[model samples]
Target: MNTILVTGGTGYVGSWIVKGLLDKAYTVRLTVRDKDNTAKFENLRQIALTTKGKLEIWEADLLEEGSFDDAALGCDAILHVASPFTLRFKDAQRDLLDPAIKGTRNVLYAASKSGTVKKVILTSSVAAIHGDTKDMTEQGLTEFNEEQFNQSSSLTHQPYSFSKVEAEKEAWRIAQAQDEWKLVVINPSFVMGPSLSSLSNSESLNFMKDILSGKYAMGAPAIMFGFVDVRDVAKAHILALENENSQGRHLLAERTIDVLEYAQLIEKAFPQKFKLPKKHAAKFLLLMVGWMFKLSSQFIKRNVGYPLRLNASKSREALGLDYIPLEQTVKDMVTQMLDDKLI
Candidate 1:
């Protein structure tokens, strides 16, 4: 069986990827920032106990150079899924950029040192595809696909997206410089589904809680997202590693819809349990009260009423995936959050 290393194995999206790998009977070496924080991985350990796969947790910090060498040694493949993702940050460079760019460099450099690694699968985001939703029309594209790289995001604004683009570009540069290990990138849209742990730091969980907790009681902006399930993202990563032909980048969005549509799906499933947004707030209204939700005025003007689309033929044909429906994804997400008392 292949022994693989999964960075950020305790994260919302990362945990699902770990579970997928274990289901296939692969020996997984997982990295966590704090080995002392065993509470975060209790659910995962429980799953491993019931499965044929073995689990090993190692400590690795993203900022410290060479911190991942111990975990990267002797793995057949490395799934780089650890990156800071947050809109709530005072220092962009401290919180996002340094960790993303420097961390990618450190991890791959460690892989280069590790004599046995054959492939590296990076978990990038559609954020690397474009910064704002309005960029589709501005960039003269009918759909944002693998060919597009976000050029509009900056440190002061859309910093998370900027970090992803820089990290992905750095991965490509590193991969080209070496013939020993190849790189493949999975650029997923908004990933939503059940997380293994309830106390996750994922912005996705926060977004869902805000929706169900009436933060958008009046309404929400008309921004659209190309949505995909968390499990599918993991599946795509494994497929990329297994398929020698799976080179370059693959966009992993199953469908596209606005926040209002997502709200409707949750409402349809959990009818009377929580507050759900019923209408789209006007752009002017969003811009006026943007600070309340941490979204800037420029973001509102550019993306509040724009459309988003992603070409999925590459993922469909190359990964051979049957994606989970957006509606079902939302429903399952809400149910799990409720059961976990996360929302």
Candidate 2:
């Protein structure tokens, strides 16, 4: 459990996990799609130079089979955190499902092949647990938990959610078939915080940018979303790796808030600093004009006006997680983006 292989080490969430592991003096091997792009991981490399942890960069592709075999050699654990998370895609199966599902299968296959690997942590999103906020009412549950599986998303509807569900399911299938290694899933809600690198194209960053840059100045959809700090999510992953009792799935979220509440929090933190949305647009208006915002009518109907709730007792009880307040999360993230001139 000393040497760990981390996929998607350059990503927003993965970078934090890698930094946490590096800070703890663990031998962390990070897999990237391209090793030649030194700037993508220059910050991590500099951190590794200062920290006790050893960092190695290996080039691997999610779409290619046997790509992770070399990187997984002699590794005690694998942290599979790489997956596509964009909303706009031309082909759902090729752009989302294949990379996510096949990527999980390939990474786990490497772990099974590696005799040294005894544990694996997969970064699955809350999207996998439930597709739409409307699902909360339809399923007869007030809050979401680890036991629920997303059943509403498909190739045409919320394809990103569909990809995560299929990917996690594939991981579980492989984990069940093998007896050598154990699988732990970390399902996090809308993660937001100051990313270690400013070059991330994560939807979380884009969402904030859209709000601050006046893309939603007129109004934003009053969508309820579960929020969690990116740093907290990263810590949960490392905690899951270190704690033997951490098994199965753990839901990681701080609290639930609507988009208007989020804007209010931002306004409270920095009064009149940016052109913020004054109110939530009507759901009916969103259903008609959501296409301009890249939201389909079905998306608006299913998620725009629903309340999203999640029970994170397992994370607190099992991982000893004390969530960061939503106010601080919003402030820190906005400050970082502003300092970096990203928005």
Candidate 3:
């Protein structure tokens, strides 16, 4: 069996990828900041036991050079899924951009030096494709695809989107300069589903919690986002790693829905606990809140009431992916939140 190095194997999406890889009987080496933090990775070990695959934890830090070299050695493939993802950030450059861009470079550089590594699957986001909904139509794109990239985002504008764009670009640059490994990027949208671990800190989970907890009690912004199941995202990563023809970027969203529509899905699935937004907040109202909340004011101005479309045909046809329904995805997420007592 080939050994695969999985970065951020204890995270929301990364954990599922580790489980999927283990189910396929791959010897997995998981990288983390602290190898002694058994509580953080114990669940992964439990899952590995059921799958009959081996799990090895290695200490690696994104900021520290040469930290991942030992982990990358002897691995057949690498799944670079570790990146800082947070909505609330004190410094966008320090908190989001630096880690994303630098971490990606470090992983690819290590993979480049590893003679045994053949492929690398990167977990990117739809934020890299188009910064705002308005850019979709402005670019003459009816639906966003892997060929398109975010051009309107900046460190001062939409910092999270900008981070993803820069990181993926860096990955592409590094891959083009090397011949040792092939780079496959999975650009997933807002991923939602049951997490492998009981802990809930993912941005997707936070959004669901806020909705169920009445944070959006008055109304939800009309902003739209593409949604996909976390399981599907993991499966895409696995398929991209194994399939010979799977190269370049794959957009991994099932469909697009507004925030209110998402809230309604959760409320319909779990009526007793989740309170669905009754009204849709006007674009102007969201604009005011965006200013107060320090959200990219440009995001409110561009995406407040627009429909954001993502063309996931490449991932579906190439990887043979059949996306789970948004209703099912939302329900599974709510179920996990309830099981963990987060909601």
Candidate 4:
């Protein structure tokens, strides 16, 4: 009976969120840039056919004003998950910052005007919490939580992190200025697992592909991250939408592990298909590779050999979330990648 507006319904995470909502019998009004792309909405259609919920598609663009107005109307909630994510950017401002910040503003503005909208579930990244691994120690942050924000990132340091921080900050600012809608943000770390659609554009999928394809054959960087399953992340979004107690930021990571450990898990799970990197590359070599690949140089200097610690007890207790293990996530992701021939 309740209809929710889901932006980026065709995306990696958005697809799963749409499926979860439909499975719960929620009428989903999905916003996509192109309404004519039947293939993009095919998965949702199939899911809707089997579920009790109904699905509607709308044309909306983040950069264009009033584009989401129709979709937001008469909706019970808005799930704003549409944002550009890229590790390699030709122009940071145009590619990442503008769309992320402006898109949040557009969606919130639409929600503010919609009298039926009561809450907004935003998909923010862990990058919004800490800019660099060094900041974790420099700022005396033993572990990252919902309270800490990324202050060290700028357009120069880590543009993607900076974009997430600024966008989330803007969401808080907009929510403060109005009482029409409550805001709930989910800050997920590196999200992995089987994607509902076969798309492999997400950075996590790319990383998994590289690992399976032997791109990291020589060795892997010592970088560590708190990982969560894509399904759990979507479940968190839906739980936050339904639970009145859910408020503020929720760090949705299940566990933390190093890159090599992740690869070893994949190898152990599927020894015949996955050949993981046995050697660990030197920090300096990773730095050189970062330079050659034109990646964020800060990725090497700050995070390549560092351990990232995140405290997710609050999310578990508040959201009643049972996160799937990182090993299972990696195994599922690797299996999917192999089936799709992405490796």
Candidate 5:
């Protein structure tokens, strides 16, 4: 597509997609919550100046209906990448679910009404596939694939995952009712890499900061999860848009590793003394004290000490994505955080 509408274009994963689209000379209409906040999108604007692509900033709110109508109109394609990833929330429905489900509805509605948008790529998450690590064995599957939908997440447990699942479902419901626009879902695991905007406050970056800042030095919960590079995730979105044959959901994950193994990767990349967790915290210990870390007992019981695995063959074969190694991903992210004084 020559002209595209990208929601959350200034976000962590969305920024990378915007960069790739600009590099390919596509006119990108970026929708933000506030177009007046130039600093939030200055990095993207600077990149736009050097590329052949045109960048247009528009103000829109995810919670408001029809907010994306003006920005999405006349766009050849739409990349719905804006969604909250925070785990901390006072109200699950208001903080996470509303923005996610409503945002998906609004974006897809805009695309459907635009009459020009033929392709829509929704940025879902692996959290939508399986709620917790234990779901793998419980479901009698070796690894999670495109066919699965998370069944364990609820309003009180892993609310973030619940929001993603509901949002993705809403996208599918909207996409099915109409044939004018085809929907492609990109379900990426924990996205990690250097962000284009240093001021970006993503949960992925916060997870890294927690590790390097000694919050988990004593011991990290033995939580295993999938990891993927932000760049790779962005590439998947573009590939989905470019390849007409691409259909259904594409799971984008490089590999699976536990908290302790992640620390080891960091140590291997840095080789410098940082308060990296040397070992996994005992499950019982975590169960007793998990509340101190804002971890629900149900979350700790279901996720801790369980291995998370996924089958990303579709992303590789269909999207032709060669995933980045976790070591390099960790190195680049740590280096950027250091430069930004975030860690």
Candidate 6:
């Protein structure tokens, strides 16, 4: 029950999960697309060098079926955290849906075949709970929770969110078909904070860079969203693994804030370095300039200025999360990006 395999071990969320497991002295096997890509996982290797936990890397591909069999062998559990989270894609179905759904099937099938896996912790998202911030009111709910499922997003809009919800559905379908392993899901909001690895694949880190580098200096669109620290997301996974009583899905978010507030936090943290936006741009202006930011008027009207609410009571009571302050999260992320010369 001590051996655990983590998919996308080099990713932002997965890397932190690996670090937490290592800190707890658990044997962690990481599956990557390529074992020779040392640059992506060098931080993990250094962690193994300093910790008592044993770390191993194996090759696996999300799109390739049966790719995770070698890594899943002899493992007690799995953390499936690998999935694309990009806005720039030629085809949403090809780039997001196929991999997310097919990838979940691949990993879960691998675990089912392993016959040793006791639990499968799926890294789902708050996106799966609610696609748009303004969705709560229409559904007669004040805040989002584990019971909700995203129904607004599709291939044409918020494709990433659609992928997450669909993937979770597919995982649940696979889990219900067998009794060999139990499934638990961790639905984290927009994850931010320092990365365990110095890799540039994370969209969160990239968003911070854009914020500081004046990408939104001309007044950002007021797209309200929920956010959580990356470390907290990792900790939630650890709690789920240790607490055998824990089951089903849990929502993880420190708080809800808007794009303007986020920029202000960054501005306060780094006084003269970043030219953070002074105000949220007018919705009409955003609509006119939507193409520049790859947004549409409909999206701007739906999300801009709308607040998002998340009820993380389940995670608080079940996973014992005290949560991290957004200010500290912003500061830590900025400092890390500076130290790594990423900005």
TM-score versus the correct structure, for each prediction:
0.98, 0.99, 0.97, 0.97, 0.98, 0.97
Q: Per-residue lDDT for 1-343 in model 4, tens only?
A: 2999999878888999999999999999999888787888898899999998889988999988878888899999999999987887888999999999999999999998888899999999999998888788788778899999998889877899999999999999999999998999999998899977785488878878778777787887788888899999999999899999899999988888888888888878887676678978888887778665455567678877766799999788999999888778877877787677677
| Predictions in order: lDDT | 0.89, 0.93, 0.88, 0.87, 0.92, 0.89
RMSD of each: 1.1, 0.8, 1.3, 1.3, 0.9, 1.2
Residues 1-343 of candidate 2: C-alpha lDDT, one tens digit per residue? 7999999989999999999999999999999888899999999999899889999999999999999999998999999999998986899999999999999999999999888899999999999999999999999998999999999999999999999999999999999998999999999999998988989999999999888888888897888998999999999999999998889998888999888788989999999998989999988888888888998888888988787889999999999999999899999999999899898
- Lowest summed lDDT across 10 adjacent residues in model 6 is found at 195-204
User: Model 6, range 1-343, lDDT digits (tens) per residue?
Assistant: 6999999778888889999999889999998887898888888989988898989988999999999987898999998988888777899999999999999999999999998999999999999999977788678887889999998899887899999999999999999999999999999999999987676668898788778889888898888878999999999999998889989999998888888898988878778778889988998888899888888677777788776789999999988888999999999988888888898
User: Model 1, poorest ten-residue lDDT window?
Assistant: 193-202
Q: Backbone collision count in every prediction?
A: 0, 0, 0, 0, 0, 0
Worst lDDT run of 10 residues, candidate 2, spans 299-308
Candidate 3: the clashing residue pairs are none
TM-score for candidate 3, residues paired by index: 0.97
Who is ahead in lDDT, 1 or 3? 1
Per-residue lDDT, model 5, residue 19, is 98
lDDT of 1 by residue, 53-172 (tens): 999999999999999998888888899999998888889999999999998998898889998898999999999989999899898889988999998899987999999999999999
User: How close to the true structure is residue 194 of candidate 2, measured as C-alpha lDDT?
Assistant: 92
Better of 2 and 3 by lDDT: 2
Off by over 4 Å in 4: none
Model 4's alpha-carbon lDDT is 0.87
Better candidate number, 4 or 5, judged by TM-score: 5
Clashing pairs in 4: none
For model 2, the stretches where C-alpha displacement exceeds 4 angstroms are none
